[model samples]
Target: MAQQLGGRARSLQEGPGEYRLDNGQHILIGAYTESLGLMRKLGVNLEQSLLRQPLRLRYPDHEGLSLPPGPPLLSFVRGILSYKTWHLSARLQLLARATVWLLQGFRCKPELSVAQLCAGLPSIVRQELMDPLCVAALNTPSSQASAEVFLRVLHDALFSGRGSADLLLPRRDLSELLAEPAQQWLRVRGTQIFLGTRVHTLKQAADAWHLEISGAPQGETQCFDQVVLACTSLQAAKLAEPWAPAWAQAAQALHFEPIVTVYLRAPGSALPAAMVALNEGPDAPAQFAFDLGALGHAPGLFAFVISGASDWVAQGLKETGAATLQQALQAFNWRCSPEVYRVLAEKRATFACTPGLQRPGIQVARGLWAAGDYIAGPYPATLEGAVRAGKNAALACLQV
Candidate 1:
């Protein structure tokens, strides 16, 4: 929408060089139809940009789940029935619970947590599958995450259509893959981009919105018929304080969860799979690990991600990174000892997706709207949710 509307977006780091170095790694899925569509519109070659694979969760020693290609329901059933990691009775229990959820239309009360919803399932299933899936999707522990949102995500990925459950790993940096392409696409359409600019205040005047922006030579005030605040929840709250106090309060009230990504480099070594699920605990903090070499990046470059990482962050990035390195060494086989390259932590990676949490809607006020993953939406804070919110905000602006 920024591209179509002829405006520029800013970043703390310039270009795809230093910016890419600091950005967190992200993964997408075929279920993110809106994000894929937007990428296609921006001229990204999906086939080349993403390495697609069916749902597979391989761990060290090649122990985990991998669904085969087939009809969604059949594949799910077959995968569960064929799982050898758990006892036959446990698999049957999972299948029975799945059948009940399907028969009940995946409906659950708004206040129900994922742990509560899956209370009847085998502990092994909850530990290996449900816990990891919950943290990955909602960035909240299963004990606190909303069950309704979890079911919605599962419905879209496993039952929506073919390939929906497939993972799309980016082969390059995020700016090169999406942000730069989007900026270039917008530039061709005569959009005026203001790099290094920040908006100090946003106010309404009669029928238009006014923005007082800085960070540019000769600060200027701009006016627009409609405005979309595509920024962090806190920044949006600060900007909306004058016009939307209720929205600001709600935004401020929302708590956040952290994510830590630790990069380890082991020359001449590679993981068994492109991605692997790790047994997270006090010793092993990472929930998932990615082998960048297998995904077309530098050989032996591995990324260990710790979602819902508040405790790890408190321990310090360096300490966390060293501990994760030890965890990787013990978990996987390597040609050589791996060294810690960098540890990236986003303190406020996402709003805590807790059960019964109230998020503010997109429409903050008349002629004002918000476009962010944190806004009230069916999905949690994901790339697809942000893209969907942007598209919705664009349509709302057009309608006005």
Candidate 2:
């Protein structure tokens, strides 16, 4: 894969048939905004997948349970605006309804009436094109996730007007996706990213702030006018103690929710798309799906994405993750043929999506600030939320 940077072509395929990530697979169309736009402009490749198989969904009329006709931009907005804050139960029910309506509209554009749009779908996929790419990107189930967050993401996707189609897929390894790209970006920017050098203690000097890293004996210190604590809420609290004691204490008080991704490679079985979301019942563990085989030419490879998975975070991996994938495969009526796979446990994927949860100000003290998916933002802990938070924190630091 060749990536174009500064009008120059760069080889993305360093040494590979194709690289895969454990948490999920990322289809990098281009650079962030530019690639997204270009992919959308060029047209979506959704037609060349298992999603087009016209299979019956769980609930046809119940909403997101089935595919929508067109993009659910307006209905998504309406559902989000009408929903109460942090009400997962109520919110998902409405969003599912919106998903059905949107699918119906996308399929044939049957009617413009909101009432018609409100009709329930009979199966999982009511139409031809059931691309839940947006839902996957936000990491919130289209059925239960906040519409406001979806709208924000949708706006960003359509705003740039580029023809890029970005899909979020789960790979067998986590480090394959996050660590490498981050390392590359850091390398290009000449920033130090100490992977094993964990900061254990932090204190502010008269001028520069001192940090006690895990490896170094005496602890090396670095100086800067500002520091961006981009770690989790709990970790950020530790880093901000000296600069903002009270603020750090309050930051530590912020609660978090975990997410678990289970990867499964069914050697002979095939999945619908590069990614799909499973509509599980109340007690079920697994949630989403990613097709590794869809990326170029990998085969019988798939992943299960389990979000809001606090219950099974620390359980036996082969037992919980593998079993869940087996059950999920049963849902699709596919054989539970296990191959090479792994479970990615993100202890703090996001914080609770409550009302005032979005009100945590980014400005920790004066020179100190914070940025992450958990911090105050438009929605829950997601890529878009993280990006927005980072941009906002950078601006806050620059303004000072």
- Tell me the TM-score of model 2: 0.62
| Candidate 2, residue 101: how far the Cα is off, in Å | 14
What are the Cα lDDT values of the candidates? 0.85, 0.49
TM-score of each: 0.94, 0.62
Question: Residues 64-98, candidate 1, lDDT per residue (tens digit)?
Answer: 88788876677878988898989999999998998
After superposition of all CA atoms, the RMSD between model 1 and the true structure is: 3.2
Residue 389 CA displacement from its true place in model 1, Å: 0.4
- Candidate 2 regions off by >4 Å? 1-20, 24-179, 216-219, 282-284, 314-318, 333-336
Q: How high is the lDDT of residue 266 in model 2?
A: 70
What's the C-alpha lDDT at position 224 in model 2?
A: 65
Error of 1 at 262 (Å): 0.4
Q: Write the per-residue lDDT of candidate 2 for residues 43-142, one digit (tens) a residue.
A: 4333332122211122211223332222334433453444343256545655576565355433323122222332353332222112243234444344
TM-score of predicted structure 1: 0.94
